[model samples]
Target: MSRFIPLSVPNLKGKELEYVTKVVETEWVSTGGGYINEFEKNIAGYLKIEKGVACQSGTAGLHLALKLSGVKYGDEVIVPTLTFIAAVNPVRYLGAEPVFMDCDDTLNMDLDKLEEFCRKECTLTNDGLINNKTGKAIRTLVIVHIFGNMANMERLIDIAEEYKLKVVEDSTEALGTYSTEGRYKGKFAGTIGDFGVYSFNGNKIITTGGGGMLVAKDKNLIDKAKYLSTQAKDDELYYIHDEVGFNYRMTNLQAALGVAQLEQLEGFIKIKMENYNLYKEEIDKIEGISILDFNKNTRANHWFYSLLIDEEKYGLSRDELLNKLNENKIQTRPIWGLIHEQKPYRNNQAHKIEKANYYIDRILNIPCSTSLAKEEAKYVCDILRELER
Candidate 1:
């Protein structure tokens, strides 16, 4: 059997072992250690944000952001229906409901639909943005940069400002993505919002086994996040508690791995872009299938390469292609199901969900591991072409 080519996996070619070994040797494997601080500092520097608070997972970071943003029980948050359900689950964790929005061609949140929903369906008063249907205050907007492609942040920010909504960016898949043109030019994805969350999951562009980070423009928010993540201890000596908190701090061992992984992030992203381009070049020659392009206005991380399949033009269906590729020792996957269609979100309110449903069926994610060689990428494209024929 041929070696199985994964859809996406971590590339640990840097000092991962050295840093992890040091943590074990020093017996500092818990949350407190030098590596934790170093990892937080380095990631904040990379994004040029004020500060970063290391957390257990991206979901935890999102929960912290939602809590800090004061998303109460009766509030509603705007979220994309095409993203991973994790993005919407955090809103539920805070006893709030998610108002599902549609996706544009880029598979990010549709700014036009978002604006239309706010302008036509919602009424903005001095109290806050209120949904006419549910009669709930829309307190926040959680924007996920899907597949490392940035959403229309420039217009999204303006809409959020006009409607008085706090913006929490779910940048788990868009660590290296940044704007190259417009008013917020040169700003990273997460930093442009009120609070940004990053993931270092095993399949992410970078990995720390299972960890994440939180960042904000204000240093105070970052500090408060750190304090809240560490169990909200007001007095450590007496173990005095102020309010509710969580044990969501990233462990020292995880931070040790994160520091090393972050060191190679730029290089990994470069390889990802190159590999995506190679796939695009070969697949473009075939009829009925094409690789989607990132927003030209942004320096996208190019984390995941999605193949848009036209079943009528192409001989095989998307599912057939996915099955054939897996049978041949290549891993591929379809996009996530629409969030509003999920069981938990079935009762939730969805606004103008047209494009998201359209793309969900036609999109197939191909092999995009950073360690994928040029020949391997070509091989995947060649197989795809053959399948198309």
Candidate 2:
């Protein structure tokens, strides 16, 4: 047997120990410490956003972002069906409905259909406000930058602006991706949205055991987000509460880990991109395997290097290859099941989900972790190449 190859894992070679050790010595292991604030500052600095509120997890961040976006009972938020359910669950958390949108080959919202739905299926009321045909106010759009490849943010932003929709970005997979062209020139993925949320789950590019950050362009919105995360309390001498709040704040221990992860984010992104390139170069040459595409206008962190299998050409399906890869201890995964197809979201309106279904069976995410060496990446692709032929 050979060493097992992990799909993705944390890379902690930076200040994690030093910061955590200091917190332990100071006896401030929970939420009370400088590291929490320092970690917030570190991430804000790295992302160059107005502010970042660290929370219990990315799901919590999405919850806060939706709440802040004024997603209330019976509202509709347009969301991609091909995403981790966390991206859409927050909409449900607010008692809001998610109008499912389809994904293009880029694994992003299909703008053409998104626009078509807004124009044809929806009508502007006498108030000149667009509302869903179901008579619900379509209030927000939750755009996930899936697998570190950015959605077309500029066009998406334009559509949001036109529809009077608040945009909340699920940027959990796109920590270091940025655009170099169009209206999004020099813009990072999450920063362009009304509320940008990130995850530091254990398998993410960076990890704080489990944590999340919420960022926004407005300083007041960011402050309000922090307030909401801290339990919506007014100035408190005796824990006076104004509105319902959540204990969603990140702990000092998690922030200590975050500080360390922040210090090494750039290096981790470099390794991830290099590994993606290596996968593309080595695997794309095979007859029936195609490397996933990245948006050149923006550089993706290349979180997951996906291979789209030509099932017809190879006389095999993606699941067949997936099973074989698993048998060989080469971990690979299928893309997320479309959310609209799920039991919970079945009643929600879906627009043109054909493209999402197209890529769903074909896309297989390969290991492209920062911890993976060049040789290990080559070996994984070699397995795929052998399986292909």
Query: What value does the lDDT take at residue 139 in candidate 1?
Result: 88
**lDDT for each residue of candidate 2 in 64-164, tens digit (9 for 90 to 100):** 99998888897788899999999999888899889999888798889999989988888756433355568888878999998999999888888888878
lDDT string, candidate 1, 329-384, tens digits: 89999999998999999999999799988898899999898999888888897788
What is the Cα-based lDDT of residue 238 in candidate 1? 100
Clashing pairs in 2: none
Q: Which segments of model 1 are wrong by more than 4 Å?
A: none
Best by lDDT: 1
Model 2 bad stretches (over 4 Å): 126-129
Best by TM-score: 1
